[model samples]
Target: MEVTTNTQVNERELWGGGAKPFSASYGKIMMWFFIVSDALTFTGFLVSYGFSRFKNINSWPIADEVFTHFPFLHGIDAPMYYVALMTFILIFSSVTMVLAVDAGHHMNKSKVTFYMLLTIIGGAIFVGSQAWEWKNFIKGEYGALETKGGQILQFVNLENDKRISIQDFAIGINSERKTHKSNIGLWYQNEKTLPKITVEEVKKGFLANPNLTIRTEQISENGQKTLLSRDEAIYKIDDATGVVEGANLIHNEYGNRLFADFFFFITGFHGFHVFSGVVINIIIFFNVILGTYEKRGHYEMVEKVGLYWHFVDLVWVFVFTFFYLV
Candidate 1:
């Protein structure tokens, strides 16, 4: 007889008998595999974002300035406050999901239903808040002038040192302004909606206002935008090619265009995940009400969805740290 090898023994331990590896069922094992692969996908996205951000460290938009808006708190500078709240809501929803899973384990249908409802409510609020944030971001608060080199220049009041909106200072010129359509322009090209004011009008307004100064996109050592002197401001204003009113794939009044691109792609991807989770959670919630899992002698479905929910919440934590805090 031949001596037993380690590889043969390991194979026997793994597959020779009808034994559950790690005592996990087939569905649970498959879910873990899916989560591991999904985690790698998010990791790749965040790594790409980090590299791009480091490359444009000087000109990357400050999260505090960009995310200052809060619900029902117009004109207030609440930087990162609302984002913190959203994070709390999501984390709490994860907690409720855990409770739901625990109730499912004990076959407590009423408890599972209650916690599942809470989780769904929290997720819905988060999705709604994200939508509102996107609306504000797309409808940018302050407009800026973009140079041929794709640099953005904002305006500020020299006296009070407060940020100024292009709409607040841009003069209305009596000129025929029309959207560029494919019929009038290139057959395959169509221009985005034109800003209310043109660069020429903005130049005139800046020249007329002596108290206005220009703030470059470059971040200073003190973590503030570099403000130009009156003469320097006027000189830079001459280089203005177009007026950028909001964030889009092409232009961003905030700062670097790449920031907007990554923001849309990564956040939109995560938001889709949240929306899908909410829908699946609703389906599971109804199933719990109908006692489907109870008849099956186990609540493994709730546990599986709970795993996915926790993964989504965990991914958001890293995302928030990267996009908002960092």
Candidate 2:
């Protein structure tokens, strides 16, 4: 009589046993399935994003102006630097995850724990930095004027090519005692309103300042922005110092509503993923502390999470290319 032993039962048979529960290597299989599904989800999002980007053919905010913020420099014209740093942080975390898995192979608990800690730290820093980036983006810079056709027009100092802001043209006015004040008792107390400055004020300032020139947001790849000569710029406006009406999102001072929407959705989604990735890393970090994988004799958990970390990095590469470099 032939008897079946555990070793004799092939992996396929074990997993596909008649009316049997799946007996495959749980970690690796789950990791692969998760990755496949996640890939499809990301693909859907990116494709939809692409469709919107393509549909909005004429006017898009230049990614450079939209994301230009640098650390310690306050409000300098540094675009893509912070995100580049975040990208490196995620990539570095992936390396640490791999190192953690390698250490787990030799049952070196200390090394595994150390690398895992570093990985968690990297993920956290990336999320925080991303938050700052998003904050700056939503607030906007050099607040634009949107035309009826949905084009953005921006201000620039012609002599130096430095962009101008509404703040530069702002002449602070003294508020009356009857002026509306923010509610203090609300859960989110009153925030100070941004002082209003008119487009006319800006144009008048520009006229006075000969170095100033106006550039429309419709720029080509060659760095040529459709610009307005001083006469043309001042000519279009009935009131140079009066504020251009409407929010910057719909008919931005730059021109396209789609640009702001895409900026919010695409980068917002990517930032959300980064936030969730950090949360997952934190959970894995605690698992490492508890020696959960050590008991299993495999650090496949770390490897699985590592794959996710790398995937985030990979997505960012495409985003950077399309949004900035391209």
For all candidates, what are the clash counts?
0, 16
Q: Candidate 2 — which residues are off by over 4 angstroms?
A: 1-24, 56-58, 170-195, 199-211, 238-255
**Candidate No. with top TM-score:** 1
Off-target runs (Cα >4 Å) in candidate 1 are 1-17, 182-190
Clashing pairs in 1: none
On a 0 to 100 scale, what is the lDDT of residue 69 in model 2? 83
lDDT of each: 0.91, 0.67
> Evaluated with lDDT, which candidate comes out highest?
1
TM-score of 1: 0.92
All candidates: TM-score: 0.92, 0.77
